[model samples]
Every structure is written in structure tokens, then in C-alpha cells.
Target: MALNPNVPANQEQRTDEIDLFELFSGLWAQKWLIVGCSALALLVATAYAFLATPYYEVHSILRTTQLKELDELNGTGVYKIDPEEALRRVGASLDSYETRVSFFNANRELFEPLKKGSGSLENAFAAFNEEQFTLLQPDPRKTSLVPFVGLKLEYPADVDGVAILNGMVRQAISDEKVRIAQDLEGVIKSRLNVINRQLTAARAKYEASKENKIAGLKEGDEIKRAQLQDELKALRGELRLRRQSRITQLDEAIAIARSLGIVKPTTPTSMGQDAGAAQGNIIRTEVFNQQFPLYFMGSEALEAERNGLLKRRSDDHTEPRIAKIQHELQLLENNRQIQFMQSREDEDLFLAALADLREESSRLENIKLDLSQLQLARVDRPAIEPIKPIKPIKMTIMALGVVLGGMLGVFAALLRVILRRKANALA
Candidate 1:
């Protein structure tokens, strides 16, 4: 009846090996479960994929080029609402500032164009420069992600998902919003026209309105223009004196000093603004190619080298005057570079100012044109079409439900097995 300790130890190791084998064998032992689970997983997946609701999403992308509108964002942080502006005007002018002022005053017919209501949007909503774009929808069910959620909704298998998505898009371009936008545009055009007429009449009556004001503005502008030009000319002269024919000598010094590895530098630049409105933003980039390594040589040497190169001096290496000219030349080139940078900075400032003034001028001219057009025009709304039923997509939902059910079934089985093993251990 006495068991050897060595025999007990070997028996324990064998039991562990057998347990491993048994665990390995269970996958086959549980073959029925594997089949049942697989079938259940498949069934669940089918129900979800087929019976589930399909969802379609839609989106519109637009960029605002509202150039001067930057002032709204930066200055006041107010978003522009075209419809809102129209309504405000309509309300203000309504009933002659009194809701009960007069029947004639309350008459919206005369002011139909100015009406801020959704009705007005029909005629005058402005369309900016845009390329007409179209997109095609693909069968997402084939590789549907997040299908389970759609499946859970039990979305009608025959439910038209595309129709639903299209409806949302149509909602975005809401008829009322579009109508109101058009109306607002009309009102602006009308008001802007009135202003223009008043301005024109005033100009005609005053005869000296534009000329007088512009003359004064121009006088001030002229003084500033002259000052800039004078400074620019002076800077150019300074630059020329600094470099001129003296550059050849300095270049040799830079070549000799290049081995010292001082530095090569780059600076960022914006293109000049002469390209015009039709070009939008096309610009030519210019980069100055000047390489100055160091000022090891003097101006006197540079002058001698220049003279030698020009054949004005004999070819002699022992010329003591060369060093003196080289040093002077180096000083001159430094002065020239400084002047050149100063000129560049000045030009950039002037150019930026000119661009702003020009842009403002363009806007003013547009306003004038709009006012004139308003005086001569009327806008009409297009006919609206009624909504129709959307098409159904059943396959989308079934695929989704299947994948979700399979995952859920797997987790549930895992949990059940863990619990059963724990219970057995306790028993």
C-alpha cells in the first residue's frame, strides 16, 4: 500500500500531459458544438444582414471665396446671413414701421422682391463661380462596415436607402432657404441700385463730386507715391555704387572663401500682384541668385583684378595695390547688399498697399455695376417639383446582421465555457 514518491511525481507529470491531450481533443469532441455554433452564427448573420435597415449618407462640400468677407471673420466674427438681411429690411419697411400703419403700407406685393420670406428665395439667390459636380453611390453592403447597427434597426429590407439619402441632401438645399436667398439677393440688388442712382444723380447734380473728392485723394496719393519712388531711386543708386563693375573682384573672394563653409541661405517670397483678376492667383516666383561667402579680400585688390581682367593693367601677381582695392570692394558690396534689402522691403510694402487699394477699387466698381443692373431688372422663381418615393436596398442589412450576430455568439460561447469550467473546479 506504500506509494513511492518518485512514482507519484511521474504520475503527476503524466496527468498533466494527458490533460493537455484531452483539451486538444475537445475541439473535435465538441465538433457538434462547432457545427451548431457555426450554423447559429450563419443564421444570425443572415437575419441581421437581410432584415436590418440600410442607411445612406449624403454630404455637400463648398468653399467660401468671400475675399473681403474676411473682415466679417476677423473684425466682428459675424457670419453673413443673406436671408436674414432681407427679412430685416422687409420687416422694417413693412407697414411703414407700424404693423397697423396702413393697408397700403402692409401690401407685400409692391415689396415682393424685398420679402425676406422663403417665397422670395426663388428668384434671386446668387450662384458663384462653381463647377457642376456629380457622384455615384456604391453597394456598401458588399463590404459594409457598421452593418450591425443598420440590421438592428430592422430597416425595411425594401426600404429605399438611396431615396432617404437623397432626401437629406434635398433637405440641405431646402426650397425655402434657397428661395429666401434669391429674394435677399434681389433686395440687395434693388437697394444697391437705389444707392447707385442716388449717387449718380448726386454726381450729376454736383458735377464735381467724384472729381473733387478724387482730386483731393489723388493729391495725397501723389505725395506718397513720389516719396516712395524717390526712396526707391535712391536705394537703386546706392546699390549700383556698392556693386557695379566692382563685383568681379568680390566673386573671387567668395570662391576662395567657399571652402570655409560660412553658409548658403534662403528666404520665403510672395509673388507680385500684377497678374489681374482673370488670373485668379497665378503668380511667377523670383529668387535672387547671389552668393557671398565672406569679405576676406579688400576693395583695392578688387579694382586691380578688375583692371587686370579688363587688360588695363599688366599681368603681375606681385601687385601690392590689389589687396587695397579688394578690401574697398568688399566694403562696397556689403553696402550694396544692405541697400538692396532695404529697397526690397520698401517695394514689398508698396506692392501690398497697392494690392489692397486695387482690390477695394474692384469691389467699389462691382457695387456700381450691381446698382445699375438693379435699376433695370426683375427676378422670377423656378417651379418646384414634389418629392417621390425612394428605392429599397435589402441586401445591405442582411450582410451587416450576419457579421454582428457571429461576433456576439462567439463572445457568449466563450463566457459560458469559462463559467462552466469555474463551476466544475469548485465542485
Candidate 2:
């Protein structure tokens, strides 16, 4: 029983070997079919390679502008746009779909090929962005390399991609320049408005201050004049009372003198002695502890003094302070400082900051830069016509076709062998 088990194993191994041999022999018989299919596929691929539409790729590179190139723009105080920012703006404009559409619409003749077979202008342009136009930039992960942005356009041999790329770049630069100029103008206008407002306020403040000063001066003058008038009135009243008291004392003393029969002025010693006994016309005065009465003078003299006091026209002339007050009031009638300020034709002279504001405004107003000369971005490399088509490679397509054809032929050969085996078993 053991010897019989080893013999069955040997027979199964021999059957597997025979089956492998038959499979190889069947595939070898179908070698011509595989070769024929491969040849047919290669021919079709060759024909397609020569007949298919070839697209050419054109590229233009843009770099940041040089510092010296933007000197005028940077020098302008109102607005400053740097080279990197300018380059970024241009790149943004180039990357915009709207910008691409605008360029396409403007140069319809140049883009006539894109419109072909496309449903509408929108669809054609949309397809154009997806297939033909490409926005390129340096790798962000690589920091050591100089940053640059590029525009790539792939077009058929019938279209001119070079002209389109160059035109777009120039248009983007021109648009950015216009935007910078407008921004500068807007800033200058806003600053000018602020300066004008400040100047107006300063003038108003100056005029108001001048009027206030004039009013204060007038008020001060009135107060001073009033004080002088009060002092002068009090002095005049005191003088009038003193003069009236003297007149009353003189009247009483005159009656006393008339009762004593003393007509001329006499001293107390004379009143005791006889006036007729007096030698010569020389008058004798005695020093006494008491003050001499006003009646010491003759009646005629006292009457003359009283009459002069009553007939006096003005007391202001007698007081020095009254004359000084009148002089000060006359000066206040026309203040030189107030007149100078009021008559000033140029108020900016007094306002030191106004001149500076005006100068700044004038500088901004006179700002003139040749925007056409400004360079928004530098064209590192201009677009050039492609030397070769970037389409379906003939060699690659033919190779793939050969491989696929061989695969199909082998499957057909296997299926035929299996069907023959089943038919044989049925028969």
C-alpha cells in the first residue's frame, strides 16, 4: 500500500508538466496574429502623430523693477510704491481671469483659433484659461532663488502667442502706473483739503483774537477814565467845600472887623495897639501857636477870592491825573496794534505754521511725474516663438500602442484554446 501511494504522486507531477508544454505550444502557433495586431497599432499611432493638432508653448518671465528705476515714484512724498509690490500687482493682474478675458476680447483676431468649435465667447475663454493660459511662479519652498513670475501660453501653430503675451504684460504695467498716479493725486487732494481747512480756522482764530484784544483795550481804557473822573470829581468837591467854608469864615470875620473898626489886614499885636501910630508902611507879622483866620486879609481881598472861586469854569485843568486820563483815552481811541492787525493784508505772516502748510500744498500741487516713464515690472525674458511642438510624442504613442495590441492578441489566443478544449470534451 505504501509503494502504490508514491506512484500516484509521480503521475500527477507528469500531468502538470504536459499541461505547461501544451500551453506554450498554443501561444507559439498564434505568434503571427500578435505580430500583425502590433504592426497595425503602430501604423495607426504613426498616422495620428503626424495628423493631430500640435500646440506650441511660449513663456515670458517678469521680475521686480530696479530701485533706481522707481526713483521718481519713491521720491514723491504723497505716495510710495515699492518694486516688489509693483511686481506683485502686475502678476496679480496677469493671473486674473477677467484680465485674460479682456485681453482676449480686445484682440479677437489673434484669438480666432480659440473661438473655433467653442459654443460661445464665454465658454471659449473659459477653456482658454484652463488649457492655453498658465500663470507660473517660483517655488515658494525654495527661498534662496530670486523670486519671479511668468506667463505661459500654449497655442496652435496658426496663432501668435508671442504678440499676445507681450501685449498683456505691457497693458498690466500701464494699468498699474495709472493706478499709482491716481492714488497719489487722491492723497494730495485730501491733504490740500486739510491744509485749507486749517488755514481757514487759523485766520478766524487770529481775527477773533484781535477783536478780543481790541475789546479788552477799550474796556481797560474806560475803567481808567472812570477812575480818573471819580478822583477829579472828589478833588473838585473838596476844593469847593474848602472855598465855601473860607467864604463863610471871611464873612463872619469881616463883620467882626467892621465892629472893631479894623478895615485893613492887621496882626494881633496891631489889634491891641493903634494902627495910626504905626511907623512907616512896613507890615509886621507875629508867630502864634494858633493858625491865622481867613479874615486877616482885607475884606476887599476876601470878597475877590470868593468871587473868583464861584466864577471858575473848570476844575479838570487843575488836576494832573485828569489831564493824563484824557491823554490815555485819546490814545485808546485809535490803538495802533489793533489797526495794524486789522489792516494786515497777509495774515499768514503771523501764523508761522500756515506758511509751512501752504508750501506743502504748493509742492503737492506742482507734483508732476512722467507716469509713462515709470516701470511697474521688469520683463526678465520676453516671449519667443517655440521651436518644437509640445504635443503627442510619436515614439511614446507608438510604444504604448504596440504593448496594448500584444496584450489583446494574447487574450484572444487564450480564449480560442479554451473553447477548443471544451468542444473536444463534448465530442
Candidate 3:
């Protein structure tokens, strides 16, 4: 079979190859140009290394010992003045890039005056305008104020520039911490005072209501007069005395008859059995029974009434009265009970008040304990602490010089080639 003429170009053998030796020989023809470029690059790199300014960095470490915890059940976490992954969240916000920015902005005016004094005002402002002296720090979301910050100050190193940078950071951090401490302390004291005053007032009101309920119970009722006592049955000895009163009444009646010349008392039953006599006897008996008792009772009652009554009453005796005065007494008793309940409620309220007061007292006591612990944590805050040290860096100034010098050498060689080509064409 014939080889397929339609086979892809990849199957065919390639003719071109990179001639490394020939290329090297061609470059050697311009060896002096390459050497000059290399020499220029070395000189430029050395000058740049010597001329660059050195930067000094000073840092400070800050942490919040009183960082708030979300769970109240996790008691004394803040008191421990300890850090955790949770504490790191607020720690990140405490001050990160923001603190550095504020520090530079606040001292901007101060920097200008110093620069003018050092005769570098024009140069300093020039650098500032060019965005060379920009202050930078890790974003707050990513940074923890724990161990430390790599605080930095980049200025043309000379005279007191380094000293001022160091001083500025130290003074700023110290002032910020003092202000924070005083603010936190004041907040605790203020809340404690308010709670104590409320507790005292509530306690006093509760106590007074309890005492008044006890004193009002002993005084009895005042509803009826003494005359109303007659409706009740007389006592046993009293009924016996009434029988004796009937005998005395009989004796007196006989005396009256004797004084009228009849010695014996009239017999109401002695009348004959004939209709008129029977009727008269029945009438006399009825009269005797009814009149004798009425006369006897009327005489005694009249005598007593005359002696004791200031004026005769209307004699309308029945007033719908309370038998035991039980409901009225019950009402008064209910009033007493209500007062008792009020007193009990006062006691209960005071108990509740005491519970609340105890809670507040316990809370304050815990805060006081926490404050004591925090004071120590504050002391351990590092001064001008460093998290990472900056090392001397090699600049790419030499690399740029080498590249640019080589480009110039190639351009000169290209000109020489073009001139030779033109002269050969002319010949």
C-alpha cells in the first residue's frame, strides 16, 4: 500500500533546530558591550544600597482583661482576665489597623513641625504626597492585639527621628489604656450606687405595712343598745323569781279584798252550772288567768320603767336584728383578715425584695472580685513589644540596571549591524 499523503504535518520530519553554539559565537562578537552593561549594573546597585534610608520600628502590646462574655452561666470568665478564641473576636476589634491609622492622623501636625526643624520639610511632604509614608496595619477582622503589633515608623533615619517615633507610640498607648480603665471603673461604681438606693427604698416601704395590721384587731364591736336583751330567755333563777312574784301578787290582791270587807279571794270557778253562771264562770276564769298575769307583769314593769327610763320609748320593739352579729363580725373579721393578708403580702414582697437585693449584692461582690484580678492583668501589658522583627531587604535596583544596560548594548549592536548591511548593499 502507498503511504497516505494526507498524514498530518507532525508525522513529517522537522528541518529547523536551535543552533546554541552559533548563537553564543554571535553574542561574543559583542562581548565588550555586554561587559560594559554588566559593569554599569554593578555600580548602580552599590550606589542604591548605600543611599537607601533605614527604618526603625517600635511596637506595643494591648489586651482587654475585662472582655465581656455572652453566657452569664459562664461565671467569672471575665474575672479570670484570660483569653480564648472567643475573646479574640473582641480582641480583634480592640485596636488593629484603626489604632495605627488614628495614631498617624493624630500626630500629623506634630510630624510637620519636626520635619521643618530638621530641614526636611520639602522632602518629607514630597514623600507624603507621593504616598510613600503611608501607615498600614493588619485589618481588624484578622488581627489580635495579643502578643504584639509589628509597629512601624519609616522616616529618613537621622538625628532624633527614631527617638520621637518610639516616644509617640509609648505615650499614645499609655494614655489610651488609662482612659479605658477609668471609664470602666466609673461604669461599675455608678451601676452599684443606683442598685443600692433602689434596694433601700423598697425595703423600707415593705416593713411599714406589716406593723399596722397587728394593732387593729383587739377592739370589739358597737352595734346594739342594752334594752334589746329582753328578747332572750331569762336565766333559771330569774324564772324562779317570777313565780315568787305571782305569789306576792296573789297576797296583795287578797289584801285589797279584805280591805273592801271580803277576807277570802274571789273564786272564779264557784259560779253554778246554769247557762248564765257557766258563762260567767268561764268569763271570770278567762279574765282571772289573763288579767292576773298581765296586771302583775304590768305593775312590775311599770315600776322598773319609771325608775330606769329617762323617757318612755315608742314601744315598737322589733328591729330586724343580727342574732350572732355573725355577718357584721365576719365583715369586720374579713377586714381584719384582709389587713392580715396585706401584712402577709408585705412580708412576701419583702422576701422577694430581699431576694433581688441579694442577687444585686452578689453581682456587685463578684464584680469587685473581678476588678481586683483585672488590675493585675493590666500590669502585664507589654511595653513596645515586638511580634515580628523586620530584616534588611535586598532591593531590585541592580536587577533593573542590568536589564536596562543590556537593552542599550543591544541597540548599539543593532545599529552597527544595520550600518554594515547598508555599506555592503552599496558596494
Candidate 4:
């Protein structure tokens, strides 16, 4: 007989192929085994459900409030807290070993029952677990704004978990407030120091310029001229001093605004119309100072001409020449006083800058007051005692046990069939 070309060279490969119906029938034949295993698992699950200690979860909702006032005085907008970042920080803090120990100590009454003999306090402290605390940001999807955060604590039902969780939240908020205040104060002080240094330099420059100008003038018999020069110098010095003072005040105001979490407005170079006029006056004074020597020389030439007329014994010429010389001298004196007028113009500029600084400072002070009064975190919902136990859900445990038992039974029945077949093939 000729061997069929379609016949397999290895019959073992065909034997390895599994039939679903046959496997199901094999399992079905051991129905009592499956039922007995399932019943044993159910009994164990029921025993565990009754014996395990129940846990109660207590949770609270906290809403972060405005640490700084709304509508900043400097028009920079209000400061906002990042809820997600804050939650992460608070979570880490609560999970710390030190924090957990502190929490347990603070609520000693709650954990007293957990204490065992002579080392009761030590045992109680050891019972504190970082895992018991949880911090969650409820609306993570709302990234545009920080959402309210939730804090939860889980402990045995016998413990006062609600009180412990509430206390922890309050302490965390207090620490946050202190941290923010210290940071703001440090930044403001650093900026204030820089402004102070600039102000000192400006004042020194103004003083040095005033002294140099006064010392440069030559002494002469022109008493009126001397007096006018002194007055003009004094006026210029006063104007410069005022300007420096106003700048210093403006810096202080800006610092205050920054401390309140407000964007500090740019320090203005000019205070509107008055500042423009002051700048113009400064330029005009510089030009006049340059031309002062020419005016003085002209007055001296007129005086010499009048003396020559007197020596020639021409009364008519002498009288007219004297009058002309007097007129020229008066005009020269007026021109010299132009510097004093310029200084007066600059006074208005300094005054305007000072006014602006004062207004800004006042607004910042008001904001600071408001912030001091505001609370950092408000309790939206205080934690309460949980109504039901959270752990060892009976129904879920029993269902899992039943499924596992059925799977184990089917596996065992299949293994028995495979071992018998292997033995027969060996024989």
C-alpha cells in the first residue's frame, strides 16, 4: 500500500492542538471539585471580612484666598497662588516623618488606645504613618486657575481622624502664610537698598556741583553782583536737592507696591508739564552761564567810557555816558539773575514728582493693610466623621474569591488529563 502524501510526518504536533469543547467537558466532569474549592474560598473571604479592622476616611476642603489685595496699586494685577504646586508641597510636608510624628503628638488622645505597655508613647509615635495623609487638587483639568484642594486622612475607626486632619490643614496654612510674608519682605528690602544707594549718589553729585560753582567765582568790588551769584547758586542747589528727594521717595513707594505683590510702575523720568519746563530751564541756565562773561565785559567797557568822559570835562557827554552805563549795569544784573528764575521753574517739577510719590505710597499702604487683614486659607468644608468603613468591601472580596476558585479547579482538571496522556505515550 502507498503512503498518502497528505499524512503528517509528526502526529505529536496534531495532539498538541487544543479543543475548547473537550477542555470544557473535562472541567464539567469535575463539577464537585470546582464547587468544593469555590465554597472553601467563600468561607475564607467571609471570615476575613468579619475579622479585619475597619478604616474610616476623613476629608476636608480648603480654599486658598488672596494673600495680596486685588487690583494692585501699581496696576500690575493681583497675585495668585498655584493650587497644584501648593498641593504638592502640602502633600510632601504631610508625608514627612517629622510631620507625621508631630501630628500624632498633637492628638495624643486619639492615638492613646493604640499605645501598648511601658513604651506606650513610643509605640503611639511609631504608629504614625505618612501614608495615612493625602493631599489632592480636585480640579486638575482646570489649569488656567488654581482650584480648591482636598486633604484626607485615614485611620482606624476608633481614632479621631477628623480632628487630626482638620488641625493639620490649619497648621499647613499658617506655615504657608509665614513663608510668603518672609519672601516678600526680603525682596522689598533688597530693592530698597539699591534705591537708597542711587539716591545717595545723586545727592552727592548735586552738592559737589553746587560747591564747585560757588568756588569758581572771582571776588571783586561788585557787591550786588556777588550777592546775586550767591542767591542763584543757592537756588540751583535747592532745586537739585528737591529733585533727589523726590526720586528717593518714588523709589520707596515702588518698593512698597512690590512688597504687596503689585507690579511697580516705571519711575517716570519727567513729571509731565512741570518736568518739561524744569528741563528747559536747566538748559537755559547752562546757556546763560556760558554767556555771563561777555555780559560782565560789556559792563566794564561802559564803565571805562564813562570815566573818560568825566576826565575830558564834557558835562553833557559825561552825564549821558553815566546814564548809559547805569542802564547797562542794571540790565547785566537782571541777566545774571536768570539762573535764579530757572531754579524756581525746576521747583515745580520736583513738587510734582513728590506728589506722585506720596499718592503711590498711600495706595500701597492701603493695600498692605488689606492684605494683613485677609486670611490665606479658608475652610470651605470642615472634616467630619466618616459614616461607613472604607476597607474590606465584603461583596468585592467574595466575588474575587469565587472567580479565582473556579479558575484553579479548571486548571487542575486539565493538568490531570495531560499527565495521563503523557504516561500512555511513554508506555
| Candidate 3 per-residue C-alpha lDDT over 1-427 given as tens digits, one digit per residue, 9 for 90 to 100 | 2344665454432212324564455567887887697768767765765566544344333333334432231353321223343234323433344543454466565456436555665565445434423323346777545533323344444423444445444444454445445655565567667777777776666555544543433332222222223332233335445545655655565445444443333343432244365454344433443443223333345344334433423222322343443344455544555455655644535455677776776775565332222221221323343343232233556666777778777777656655654564345
Estimate, for each residue in 23-63, the C-alpha lDDT of model 2 and write its tens digit: 77887888888788788888888888888888888899999
Q: Report the lDDT tens digits of candidate 4 across residue range 1-427.
A: 3444565646555546665776677678878788888887888887888788888888887665453432232242223444444454555554456555666667777677666677767565565454576676655455635457667778886677877787777666555555555655554555456545655555466556545654443232266565655655555566556555644544554445445333422222221336446454343312232322112223234334435433443232313444554455565554443355346544323332445444544443444522343355557788987788899788888888888877777677778767766675445
TM-score of each model, in listed order = 0.24, 0.87, 0.45, 0.47
- Candidate 1 — which residues are off by over 4 angstroms? 1-7, 17-22, 46-427
Residue-wise lDDT of candidate 1 within 220-317, one digit each (tens)? 55565565556555555554554534566466654554543323321223212332542665555555687433333433444455555555333223
Error of 1 at 376 (Å): 23
For lDDT, the strongest prediction is: 2
Best by TM-score: 2
Candidate 4 shows a clash count of 0
Q: Candidate 3 — which residues are off by over 4 angstroms? A: 1-30, 56-82, 85-98, 101-156, 159-292, 296-355, 358-404
Candidates 1 and 4 compared: the better one by lDDT is: 4
**Cα lDDT of all candidates, in order?**
0.39, 0.78, 0.46, 0.57
Q: Which order, best to worst by TM-score?
A: 2, 4, 3, 1
